[model samples]
Target: MKILACYSIKGGVGKTATAVNLAYWAARSNYRTLLLDLDSQGASSFYFRIKAPAKKNLGKRFLQAYGQLASQIKESDFPHLDVIPAHLSFRNFDILLEDLGKRKNRLRQALKGLKKEYDLIILDCPPTISRLAENIFNAADIVLVPVIPTTLSERTFEQLLQFFKQQDLSRSKLVPFFTMADARKQLHRETAIAMRKRYKNFLQHAIPQSTDVEKMGKYRTPIDLFARNTQANRAYYALWRELEPQLKKA
Candidate 1:
């Protein structure tokens, strides 16, 4: 199965929204998609109306075990979509992974058997660079980074790139896209143009800032379910269309 990680070094960049919406579209397109929420806050899980897995079932020992992991998979309201909800204990992932020694590929190895059941696995990751982040980098086929159109966001993206370079990781695996874009703001517009020009791999579609996206928390569903006609929803659809071929190539 192809794995896509929705991640960012900075929080509040629309990472979880990207993951939830993309997984919905993937399932709509007849792909068996699994949305794995790794963020301790459980935003993605909440969006899907799925409860966090109980603490006992999701601790370090059970996390990488195939049987325990498989048992935790919960079906979403949409067909062909399932989720492995995050637990509060996930906040301790860095320490847990550190205790496992230098096994950067542990997450990948744990997910190997899931390939037979899923066509796509979308990981909603926490905003940090830790041992768990290293595991995600090793596991993901393409790291989908949501970058806000601002100076600080761009700087953080650069930091992520520098980390990849220093760690000898494949920089080509990162595919960045603009999120919370406001065309009216000159800074946002200019940053978008400059970053696109600088990073040749940036996705062409940019998700706009909209109240409809913000309402996902109240609606407890993807934008398509409640605001399919809205720009934010259409933007995600376009982004998914742009990403599907790249995923095939990967």
Candidate 2:
């Protein structure tokens, strides 16, 4: 399976929305897609109208054990799409991974069994550089970072790159795309132009700041399905097209 992680060093940058939307388009393209909500807040699960994974079956012991996650997978409303619900217990992932053997690749090893079942695995990761995050970096084929065109956001993106270099992870896997961009805002337009020039790998499409994206919370669906034919959807489609070459090979 091709693993893609929607990750950022900072939060509130449309990371989860990108994951949900990309997974939707993947499924629509007849690829068996799985969206794994690793954020304990369960926002991705909520967007799909899914409940958090029950506490009775979750804890550090269970979460750390390889291959147990497959048991938590739930089918989504759409065909060829599925999800592994998020749980508050996931907040302890750092501790869980800490006490494991070969800690760095624990998540990667657990996911091996899924290669035959899924074409795409889009991880909606938590915002932090923790042990679990290292597992994600180790596992993902491409790490997609949703960046807001602002100084703080850009700094955080740089921090992510620094972390990758320090950790000896493949920096080539990192792909950044702009989020919440407003053309009317000179800061947004200027930053977008400057950053892309600085970082050759930055994605070309920018998702406009829109209430339509926020409406995903109320509608409990992806932008591709809820706000059809919108500029927001158009940008998401274009973003997916940008990643298509990599995904198509899988």
Candidate 3:
């Protein structure tokens, strides 16, 4: 199975929104998709109207085992899509990973058993650069980064790249795309153009800043389901289309 991680060092860049929408699109395309909400805040789970798994269901290791993780999978309202809702216990992930000592790839190792059941696994990761982030970087086949068209976001994206370089990680696994871009703003427009020129890996499609996207919270579903004809929905569809071939190759 291919693993796509929706991640950003900086939050509020539409990372969770991207993950929710893309997983919906992937399932719509007939792929067996699993959306894993790693964020303790559980925004992805909340968007799907799913509750966090109880502590008892997680066992003493906090569902660190593959079977425990798989057992936590709950079906979403959408067909072909399932969710592994976030647990409050996930807040201890960094500490747990640190305690494991040499097991830097623990998350990757646990996810292996899930490959048989899912065609694609989309991770809704928290915005933290920690040991859990290292496991995500090691596990993901492609790390789909949502970069907002602003100076601060650009700097954080650069920091992520620097981290990858220093750690000797494969930079090619990172595929960044512009998110919440307002073309009407000269700064946003210029930043998009400049960033695309600087980073050849940026996707061609950019999700526009739209109220329709903001309505996902009110609807508690993907924008595609509630605002299918909107530009934001179309952009996400285009993004999935663009990423599909790369996913297959990966």
Predicted model with the maximum TM-score:
1
Q: Score each candidate by Cα lDDT.
A: 0.93, 0.87, 0.90
- lDDT for 54 in candidate 3 is 61
lDDT of 3 by residue, 125-184 (tens): 999998889899999999999998999899999999999998899999999999999988
Give the per-residue lDDT digits (tens) of candidate 2, residues 38-120. Answer: 99999999999999855653746445554577778899999999998889988888877776655688787778778899999
For residue 101, model 1's alpha carbon misses the true position, in angstroms, by 1.4
Q: Which ten residues in a row have the lowest lDDT in candidate 2?
A: 57-66
lDDT of 1 by residue, 1-250 (tens): 9999999989999999999999999999999999999998999999999998655627485456887778889999999999999888888888888777879998998888799999999999999998889899999999999999999999999999999999999999999999999999999999999999999999999999989989999999999989879999999999999999999998
> Residue 226's C-alpha lDDT in candidate 3?
85
**Backbone clash pairs in model 3 (N, Cα, C under 3 Å; residues 3+ apart or in different chains), count:** 0
Question: Candidate 1, overall lDDT?
Answer: 0.93
Please, what is the TM-score per model?
0.98, 0.95, 0.97
| Higher-ranked by lDDT: 1 or 3 | 1
State in Å the error of residue 235, model 2: 1.2
For TM-score, candidate 2 versus 3, the one ahead is 3
User: Which parts of model 1 are misplaced by more than 4 Å?
Assistant: none
User: How many angstroms is residue 133 displaced in model 2 relative to the true structure, after the best TM-score fit?
Assistant: 1.0
